[model samples]
Target: MAKPFRVDIVSPDGLAWSGDAEFVVARTPEGEIGILADHEPVMASLAQGVVSVDAVGGERIRVEVEGGFLQVLSNQVTLITDRAVIEK
Candidate 1:
């Protein structure tokens, strides 16, 4: 089993979501990127699209973001965006 790591999605309003996730996929200016536990640290510019989080419990949470930045370090992923909405 893949190890879970922390994931936080935040917007100007506040924290959108924060929890343990097994995987994450986000849209970036360069294209889509997938992140897993122990991923190499990285910082990237986000594009307008959906950021998907595969939660530890097998739930998939999707967040629609306008634009922002994504940071991954020490088994944690942080997404800071201007605006975001939780997609049903």
Candidate 2:
């Protein structure tokens, strides 16, 4: 099982979601990237698409991002976007 890492999804409006997740899939300008706990640090430009996060308690959270930036470091992931909406 993957260890949980801190993840925060934020938009201009405010913080959309913040929690600990075991896995995260995000679409970057280069391609789709999967993140796990203690992954190598990365900073990338996000593409307009869905960012999927597997929460610690088996809950899956999906957020629609209208392009932004993603930063991963020290078992933490932070996504900043101009606009984002959580998908039900």
Candidate 3:
């Protein structure tokens, strides 16, 4: 089984979601990027689009972010946006 990493999706309102995920896919200014556990540290500008998180189990988390920044380091991913909506 793949190891899970910590992911935090946050907005100016507050933390949209925080949990453990096996992988994450996010849109950046350059393009879409996929991240897994122990991924090399990076910081990039996010694009206005959907961000998807594959949780430890079979669940998936999706959020629409207006625009922000994505930071990954030490098995942790942080998404900071001014606006974000959790998709049901």
Task: List per-candidate RMSD values in Å.
Answer: 0.5, 0.6, 0.6
Candidate 3 per-residue C-alpha lDDT over 1-88 given as tens digits, one digit per residue, 9 for 90 to 100? 7899999999989999999999999999899999999999999999999999999997998999999999999999999998989999
Looking at candidate 2, what is the lDDT of residue 19? 97
Show pairs that collide, candidate 1. Answer: none
Summarize candidate 2's per-residue lDDT along 1-88 as a digit string, tens digits.
Answer: 7889999999989999999999999999899999999899999999999999999989999999999999999999999998889999
Lowest summed-lDDT stretch of 10 residues in model 2?
1-10
How far off is residue 25 in model 3, in Å? 0.2
lDDT of each: 0.97, 0.95, 0.95
Compose the digit string of candidate 1's lDDT tens values, residues 1-88: 6899999999999999999999999999999999999999999999999999999989999999999999999999999999999998
Task: Assess candidate 2 and give its lDDT.
Answer: 0.95
Better of 1 and 3 by lDDT: 1
Q: Pick the candidate with the highest lDDT.
A: 1
Count of clashes, each model: 0, 0, 0
TM-score of each: 0.98, 0.97, 0.97
